[model samples]
Target: MNKNRVRLRCTYHGCELKQTGGIPYLAPYFDPLLQLLNIEVLDSSNHWKLFSKHALVHYGKQFARLGKLKRNDVIELTAQLRKDGSFVYPAHVRLLTNGPRREKIPESRTELIGYVMTQNGLYHLGGKYEYPHYVNQYENWLNKKDSTADQSKAESSSITPNQSYCHHHYGTHGNEKKGEK
Candidate 1:
């Protein structure tokens, strides 16, 4: 019942979540909530330029989906807590341009440029090619994903490149030797 956190109980299957001191269950919805709060605060300050920067960086896909850019833009994001405790964040992001940089950006290139959101607000994060800190968090996330994939691949395969291939290589399969077949 904290004033800052949005709490909703799941009605699906009568699932009751324990008070674990942290809402890890709601981690997926944190970005949406942050977006909502950011928009509200930005609108209050009437800073569409800053908002454009924010969208370009954090919402690359949503911004690319915009198709075109204008001098001013608005992106609608829904942060709904369902009765069953499920969270959905449907977004409608429209890119607005300023300073004569309006143009269609390739989806691959969109993520290359942008800003970083902090407690103070959005600031220029630069492109990935320039500063590592600009996309440090993102790069770390990608690395984490790759490592997990490698771990899974390693678990599924017993053979390693450093290991010498024996005569039973082609015949052996599923942890058994081909001669056994």
Candidate 2:
């Protein structure tokens, strides 16, 4: 297998399109137009009969990535295998234009679902949310979560033990030190 070479196959479920002997071509890369043709091969419906650029969608049980692929980038398409012997090729590029901005959600919410690239946009079957890019979403979610935790720590550290005690025991109007008579 060529290191730079990649296979382009549409393993979508219930898709009528199939290649003879299931032979897949190992291409160096798949451009926008070729990706569109791949979608046509996978889906038999008219949903993608007319479209502009298609996005290579990576579908995973807990994550996904979707976006415009570069001409030289080594691409790998993957999806969860089904028991019915039909491949769940969620990684196929679909007839999707600039759909929605890809954003990351909590990790707990990402489980048990697969990413889907459709004519409408990218969707998570497990959740109601839509994700355009999977890799970026995971990274952004981690960064956002980390920043939030750091902010919480900073807020907590700003208050000293003495300050807390004084604020809780004494009102703003009675902050003066008590002197024994």
Candidate 3:
């Protein structure tokens, strides 16, 4: 709803931390004290239990985004954030190692299984070997489908009743009904 509102975004999943909003940005003051509680990682379920249930209800599948962050990184980031009076934990702030960066497997040996990734670069006889963002493609396809449906609905409504019946008889696939006159 509020696109301009800055959120505590995850550097990994690129989603925001929902459980931390609504209250004052008090995590900075208290997150340091949490180390005393023996809560090592903010991602731990036990660590999350410290917050009230109502605060965490709308989190959906979002975790604390702490997996890629160290305890020191959290403390430092929180401390720096409080100074600026901003809760927006942006994606670019890299204080912790995201993990060992592995070199991409050479494209020469890799093959795609219809937008499905296969381990060891498994190759099928007729499969396209290109790596693609299938999820984005799927979302685009859904948008296209919805747009076309709306256009077709509008067109059908504007057409004569007889024309609408004929259009349905010979569908998009050019397959006519078995008993069509």
Expressed as tens digits, the lDDT of each residue in 66-149 for candidate 1 is 543332344344334334433344344433332544433324321222222221133334622332342455455446658887
Looking at model 1, residue 62 earns an lDDT score of 50
Residue 1, model 1: lDDT of 25
lDDT of 3 by residue, 44-149 (tens): 2423222211111111111222322232332112211232232332233222434553222111111111112332232223654232332234345446658887
> Could you tell me how far off, in angstroms, the CA of residue 153 lies in candidate 2 after the best superposition?
1.6
lDDT-best of 1 and 3 = 1
Q: How many pairs of residues collide in each model?
A: 5, 3, 0
Q: What is the lDDT for 121 in model 3?
A: 31
TM-score of 2: 0.24
- Give lDDT tens digits, candidate 2, residues 3-94: 33223333222101112232244211111112222222212341422121243332332222434232333333434433343333444433
| Winner of 2 and 3 under lDDT | 2
**RMSD from true fold, candidate 1:** 17.0
TM-score of each: 0.23, 0.24, 0.19
List per-prediction Cα lDDT, in the order shown.
0.34, 0.34, 0.29
Candidate 1, residue 168: lDDT? 33
